[model samples]
Target: MFPIRDHNPSGRVPYVTYALLAVNIAVFVVSWFGLRSEYALAEFYYTWGLVPAWLMQGEGYSTLISHMFLHGGWMHLAGNMLFLWIFGDNLEDVLGHLRYFLFYLACGLAAAALQVAGDPGFDGPLIGASGAIAGVLGGYLVLFPRARVDVLLIFIIFFRVFSIPAWVVLGIWFAVQSFNGYSATADGVAYLAHVGGFIAGAVLVLPVLLRRGFWVQNKGKPPHPAAEYLFSPSRIPRVPKR
Candidate 1:
């Protein structure tokens, strides 16, 4: 199950969030079209994506930032963008544009560091905005645990949407990431980076959460009015029984 949207709406327009989405999409398009062959794509990833081995050797330092904008595939790009779109605006609203951008970068750097520390010998390129977006999820959970999120669950041919608490969704996500980080095989997913970014984001946003007295006053929910979406009846006319 993955969250499709949240009830929490930001009080201000999230310019930084929109800019991030635009940048990631533009970079993906450039990478998708510019790299005509697999070899060239691989070369591009190696050069721009974070390589743990190179990072450990104090090489390809630029990848630490570049990798956050690069994605492994279309689904990877889509998934990261979706998460960022869902959770990022609220944090940007709270942190403001400049600070939010810095927080995103800091969380991404922390994620890269943890991934390198987790498996320093691995030479594969680590690319995706998941680590950074995971940080956004972390901060959102801290500030809006009680917020309602609509989650879509897919069971092969069956599908359904459920409204659940933000804590439930994000908490389960963190648990899965942590569990996979420890128990899963080499599936090319940087679970350690996700974990590190999440923790970093939670810690980084603590001050804002505290100053707002969100816990004491709002009780972990967003201070602003939560957006409520009501599903209306289908517009299609029903067929009469024969």
Candidate 2:
């Protein structure tokens, strides 16, 4: 299951989030079209993507940030952008655009750190925005635990959209990441990076919430214009017009 959208509409246009989407797509296109050869693509990833061994050798330090803008393929890019589109605007709303951008960078750095810590000797290049996007998921869970999200569920041939609380969605996600980080032996995916970025986002959003008085004054308060979240997905039956 994955989320396609959220019911809590952002109060403002998320310029930073859209800008990020543009950059990531543009980079992927360039990597695919300009590089032209598998060897060249691999070389580009080695130089720009986060490689734990390179980092340990006191080089490629910039990959921590640059890596967040790179992706391995179309599905990878689409997935990350979808998450960013759904959740990023909310955090941007709460924190303002500039601070949200910094928060994203900090989370990406934390994610890269944890991925390297998991296997400092691994040489393969790690490329994707998933780690940083996981951080956004973390922050979204904390601030809008009760908000409704539109999750697209796929089970073999069946497909459906389930509208559920953010906590349920993010909680299940965190559990999967943790399980993979600790137990699964998947080679390409950086599970630990996901786990670390999520934790970082949750931790980083706290001070902002406290400073803004949301922690005290609006504790447990939900989205305004409550009607916006009243309906789930399109699959659910709508009321008949009078």
Candidate 3:
């Protein structure tokens, strides 16, 4: 299942979120198109993406921040950007532009730290906004547990949309990340980074959640009115199997 959108809407314009999206996209575009050869791309990723071993050896210190904007592939970038687009605005809305940006950076840094802790000797580059985007998902779960999200479920040739609570969506995601982080032996994905980023985001947002009495005042939903979406049925006609 993939979340397409959320009912929780931010009151503000979310300039920071838009800016982040733009920067990430720009970086990906430059790396994807401007770098013509596989070697060049690999070199670029090595320089910008976080390599735990290099970091542990007191090198590539800037990668902790740069790696958040680097992605392994098009799908990787698309997925991370989509998650950020879905969950980022609301958190930015509550935290304000500057605080939310700082929170994102802190969560990214924490994620990198955990990834390094998990595999300090690994040399492969860790690239993607997934770790930081995971943080946004964490914050969204805390602030809007009951907010409805429209998810697209894909099963073989079947496809359908479902409106589920934020807790269910993010909760399942977190559980999967944690499980994979613990069980996987050689998967390239940085599941531990995701876990750490998520925890950091949730912990960082606790103060806001408490100060606003979000649980008491609004039952963990968005402070402002939630957005309502009207989903129209698909126009394509279904074809029977031959």
How do all models score by TM-score? 0.93, 0.91, 0.94
> lDDT by residue for model 2 over 1-242, one digit each (tens)?
89988777777889999999999999999889999789999999999988899889998888888999999988888988999999999899888999999999989988988989989999988888888889999999888888778898899999888878889999999998899899955766889999999999999999977777774654533455533544455554789999
Give the runs in model 1 whose Cα sits over 4 Å from its true position. 230-242
lDDT of 3 by residue, 1-242 (tens): 89999888889999999999999999999889999999999999899989999988999998889999998888888999999999999999999999999999999998989989989998989988888888888988988999888899999999988888899999999999999999964668899999999999999999998998877888877777877766734557999999
Residue 203's lDDT in candidate 2: 93
Query: What TM-score does model 1 achieve against the real structure?
Result: 0.93
Steric clash pairs (candidate 1): none
Clashes (backbone N, CA, C under 3 Å), per candidate, total 0, 0, 0
| The 10-residue segment with the lowest total lDDT in model 2 | 218-227
Let me know the TM-score candidate 3 reaches against the reference structure: 0.94
Each model's lDDT: 0.91, 0.86, 0.90
* Least well predicted 10-residue stretch by lDDT in candidate 1: 227-236
